[model samples]
Target: MSSEAKPLSGLRVLIPRGGPWGDLVSRALRERGAHTVTAPLVDFAHTSEEDQLVDALKRLEAGEFDWMTATSSTVADVLTHHNAVIPQETNVAVVGEATAVAFRDAGYHITRTPERENSTHALLEEWSEIDTGDVLKVLTLRSDVAIPVLTEGLIDRGHDVTQVLAFRTVGVPASVHIREDIESGRINALLVASAKIAEEVAAQFPQLPENTIVACVGVNTLEVAAALGLPDDADDPAHADYELKRALIESVESVIDQSDMLD
Candidate 1:
């Protein structure tokens, strides 16, 4: 389609995370004729309990666990950074497609992922259907600040579960120019992917233009954004980059329709 025919033509979108994922999202936005500003609002740091993490990975490589759970892409990065190995007999489960892709990119195979939603609750529900045998040993790797929903749910099912903090999520403030653009309404939409990013956005950019859209990646993030005082402009249940793109496009179109009606 021509640039003028694209739904997002002349739009400026703010992507709150940088690196490979941000690059991918930026490319998608540009394909739709939107100018993307890539600013990382959150970053990962090595866990404080480095020894504990190392020991857990050692056990993981020794084939002590029957199943391994990866909740985020950062967990996959941790595994790759540590050179952790998963035996052929071990099955790997992920919370969402993004995490599965991360694991696959790290040379790991995924055994299962939630069919409908990309949250821990959804993963747990899916696990109940395929769960079999007695007391399967499970290893769950997650961020330090993440709730232990998946780990607790597995334990309740009578599985031997080991919970390891894979990394720490830290907030990064956006550049002054980026902040100014957001405050001045130069930004057309803000993409929020996680609760932490939402929190940082709320903290850093307290006031947004009345017409600017706050697009969330999933239901969980939308809830967090609502709590943070961000408008419920758009959200995608799939929690994938492509889904976010669709939400942004539809939202912008809706806004344009409303403005046209007013004019």
Candidate 2:
């Protein structure tokens, strides 16, 4: 189709996360003719137990840890907030594309990133391939609510793992105006990346209009949304921010085209 006749032309898409991620997704969608609305449903807060996190960072910078892994971009934010330094000897492994970008932006070199699935399980699956021999010390920075899958998995493989809480996810309520827009079917699609955002969406937009397309980024978030009764209208297997936006635009365009044919 012509540029002026882009698939997502005149569509309204709701982006769940804010900051650079939100900006990137919004720009990509807008370029595809979708009017993007950023309603941040979740925000990261400092870990409640500050001392433990601080001590972990100290050890990390002291070359005590042989490897450090960051599962989310938010972990990069936590590292930047504390001015935490990773010794040159410590190799870094990141999971998601956004997380990789965040670490690079924060001046850290990544040693490894999962090829296909950007989940903890995926990271562990490729752990043997990335590090053939057992490493002495490994530090994992993750959200408070995140499971200790990576740590547990690594320990099983005979590696010393020190997992630290880098941040906590707090929900942000959507404004009444945004609520009205979703209830009124003004939003053509809602995109979510985490289970926390899915919970917020489920709570805020209880009665989503039938025409509102719900798109999820990662497998965990998609499963969460499905469990919460939010049908997955569109999904991206890559779980990258850009890929998700592209999928949303393409899916909405298909729906619109089918509707036009019916009319």
Candidate 3:
């Protein structure tokens, strides 16, 4: 479609994560005629609990756990970085498509993922289907700042769960120009993929322009954004990049429609 015909033709969108995923998102936004800003707002660090993490991975490689749970791509990265192994007998459950892709990319097999929503609660809801046996051994890998929802939920279900901190999430401040654009309303929308990113955005941009749209990638992220006092003008139902782009387009169009109505 022509630039004028594109839904986001004159808009600028901020993608908060950088790397191959951010590049893909930027390309997708450009395809929709959006001026994309790819700024990474969060970075991963080695967990402070190194000994504990190493011991857990050693046990995981020894095939002591029946199932392993991966909640984020950072978890998969930690596993790969540590050269962890997953015996064929050990099944891997992921929280969402993104995590599944990350595990697969890291040469790990994914046994299960939430059929519907991409949240810990959704994973817990499908837990029974993943394992019918009672009192199974499960290993859950997560970031330092992550809530122990999966671990607690599995424990409540009568399973022996071992939760390990795989990495730490640290904030990366946006460049001065990017911050200025956001504060001045040059950026039309901000794509938030996780709660951590939402936290960073909230900390960095305390007051956003009324016209700026804060779009979250999933239900959990939307909840976090709401709690942090960030406006939830749009949300992607799924964690996929394409779905996020579609959500932005639809939201921008909705705003245009409302403005036209007022005029």
* Model 1 residue 123 CA deviation in Å: 4.1
Question: TM-score for model 2?
Answer: 0.80
- Tens-place lDDT digits, model 2, residues 1-263: 65568756756889887765676667767777788899998888888868989999999889998889876777888888889998887888776556777888999888887665555666778766435775668888787767566777788887888877777889999888888888898986787766788899998888888667777655566678889998554344544344445656454332121111010
- Answer with 1 or 2, whichever has the higher lDDT: 1
TM-scores vs. true structure, each candidate: 0.79, 0.80, 0.77
Predicted candidate 3 versus true structure: per-residue lDDT over 51-110, tens digit per residue: 999999999999999999876666777888999999999988877444666788889998
Report the lDDT tens digits of candidate 1 across residue range 19-134: 54565567767777888998889998999888989998899889998899877767888988998888888898876444666788889988887665555676777776337757
Candidate 1 C-alpha error for residue 119, in Å: 5.3
Which ranges in model 1 have alpha carbons more than 4 Å from their true place? Answer: 31-33, 115-130, 232-246, 249-263
Off by over 4 Å in 3: 1-9, 19-35, 117-119, 128-133, 217-228, 231-246, 249-263
Relative to the true structure, candidate 1 reaches a TM of 0.79
Q: Candidate 3 has which clashing residue pairs, if any? A: none
For each candidate, how many residue pairs have backbone atoms clashing (under 3 Å)?
A: 0, 0, 0
